[model samples]
Target: MGHFKLLDVFAGCGGMTRGFLDDGEFVSVGAVEVDRSAAATYAANFDPTGGHTFAGDIADYTNVPRADLVIGGPPCQGFSALGKRDPEDVRNQLWREFVRVVRESDARMFVFENVDRFAKTPEFELLRTAASNGGELADFRTQVFRLNAADFGTPQKRIRTIIIGSRIGPVVEPPVTHAKNPIGDVLRWVSLRDAFLAGPVVLEPGVRDEWFPESTADFQNFQVPGPFKLRDLHVTRRYDLTSEIRYAHIAPGKSRLQLPVELQYPCWRKNPAGASDVLGRLRWDQPAVTIRTEFFKPEKGRFLHPQWENGGEQVNRALTHAEAAVVQGFDERHVWHGTKAEIARQIGNAVPPPLARAVAGVVADRLQAG
Candidate 1:
């Protein structure tokens, strides 16, 4: 079959496109990313010539080059539970640009990704209704799927809403290859210990990031050329002894609630039932919770490394950038560019390549049938 040409809009370090290319079925024709650093990161790996990469507003994308498919949607920060959920947030309606791209590109298919809460927003309702009739998306048959990254083999359980529109045929949810409860051939979810613990971690930077001639497995989901070294591997924070004591008090899979009243912060004790995962230690045997942009800060979520709370190696630090990147399904080959904070944002905002690869399979089947 002929390879499909792809256009990625609002592309964050080309995560979704990376998955598509990895599937060996699609090649990106052009990509639009407003963030200069992110676009640079995407280019660092895929578009070195600066050709076919657009690092500007999507609204200026007139006369879009024709492609077989379009992927990516503006992030749903406005609709995210973490956000203010402001009805007047301009970002909420940027889906219009996504629709415009699909229509103008005249692509046979498109895939839109967003936070799970986006489906509950009125904006999503508008998009859904328009896709069905009386709009540019009328030619396409659209389906909504709520997918968890862990279900598709990612070590992190990130639940995102996927909207697939195909002019050719109905789109189905990608089959889950991994499950918490394995039934028959389905494998169990990949555990953090399996993905992050086997390697020799450097507390500081390495001389250089080693790139082998071919793929090698350090982690099952993401294999980099070398082990975790400086760049992100050593991107750790220095929590004082007092804070260390607090983390030590929380056992694996446990949170601040475990701290005695005297040790607990007043807020934690006051709302014992609230934010159960705040200042929580990660469980070595389980899939990770969603890795947010500020994963470097342990107080934000359950990001602490699986240190022996009572005894063993002093793994008291939070998940380093390398571990979090791998858990997000970005292989070692995935090049990232930007400041420490910028890199973290790009990683946190990205789609897990494993999940996107599964979606690619679904899109490929539809395109082939059409």
Candidate 2:
């Protein structure tokens, strides 16, 4: 068979593209991404050949390159539980654009990724309608699966909805690869330590002053503090609240917000009095929480550095872009280019590369059988 061609829509940093490309059966023919910084970074990483990088809204795409497979994960913030959850959100209509491109292109298979809530939304009904109208019902078979990244070898426990459609045969969901492991086990199960040790240290200087030096003893440790009194570590900015304050703290276990109400702040850290926020230390022997775009912020979700200690000097502030890439399952050798925000956005929004590779392997096998 000829090499498979793929076009990635909403291709933030080409995570999905990387997966398909790694399979050695498919070639990324083109990609569409709206963020200029992200698109530039995607081009730098994946489009080194400088062939196709559509740096614009997917809805504006009237012509797309023909390919054997089309893959994308449209921005579903409008349908996310964290967002407005409005079924009628205008962004919901973007799926129509996806369907439109698939119909117009020569692709025989399509893979779409979105928040799990997408299946429950009226937007899904519209997607079905669009697919039917586009003649997908006549020539294609579609199936949806609820996938957990942890099930596909990612240490992070993230649930996403994956929709697969094929014109040649039924779309079978990929078998799960990794079983559920305790958060601790997930961290220890991989060769991430080896990868980190083998890679060059590429830390960016002068961004966050609170960062711990690489040589600090705290930088080498990944232990969660046992039951203990907490203390202030350092100050940094929070993403959700957009405020600058003490970003690092100590806490007992995973307990959050044990401080007196008056002293508590609206931070993502558990054990408000002790644990630090964004740059807090990660506990080794545990899977990392879902990584998000806010990872760069010290007080965004549970992105604490793995070596942080309450009242201890801040060591290893936020994760370096390369470290974030590793946790996301990208190889350390994978070069990413962009400003700090651009890189962080790419890392946060990416589909973990290992998970994508697993799905692509399944698709490749099915395609090869015929």
Predicted structure with the largest TM-score when compared to the true one = 1
Candidate 2 lDDT tens digits, 1-370: 2288888989987888877787788877788888765666566667764558887888787768897888989876755343344655567557767887787787788888887688987666656664564654447667788887767766566678888877677646776666644353333334233334433433332244332222211101222111110011122332332121333342312312433444355453344445533334455445566778767554465665554456654433455555666667776445554445666687888988777887788777767775
The lowest-lDDT stretch of 10 consecutive residues in candidate 1 is 204-213
- Looking at model 2, report the run of 10 residues with the lowest lDDT sum: 224-233
List where candidate 2 sits over 4 angstroms from the true fold.
Answer: 80-89, 132-137, 181-248, 251-263, 266-281, 308-316
Which ranges in model 1 have alpha carbons more than 4 Å from their true place?
Answer: 80-89, 198-232
lDDT of candidate 2 vs native?
Answer: 0.62
lDDT of 1 by residue, 154-182 (tens): 88989999889888988677999999999
Which residue pairs in candidate 1 collide?
205-230, 206-230
My TM-score estimates for the predictions, one after another, are 0.87, 0.74
User: What are the clash counts of all predictions, listed in order?
Assistant: 2, 28
Q: Of the candidates shown, which would achieve the greatest lDDT relative to the real structure?
A: 1
Q: Candidate 1 at 248: error in angstroms?
A: 1.4
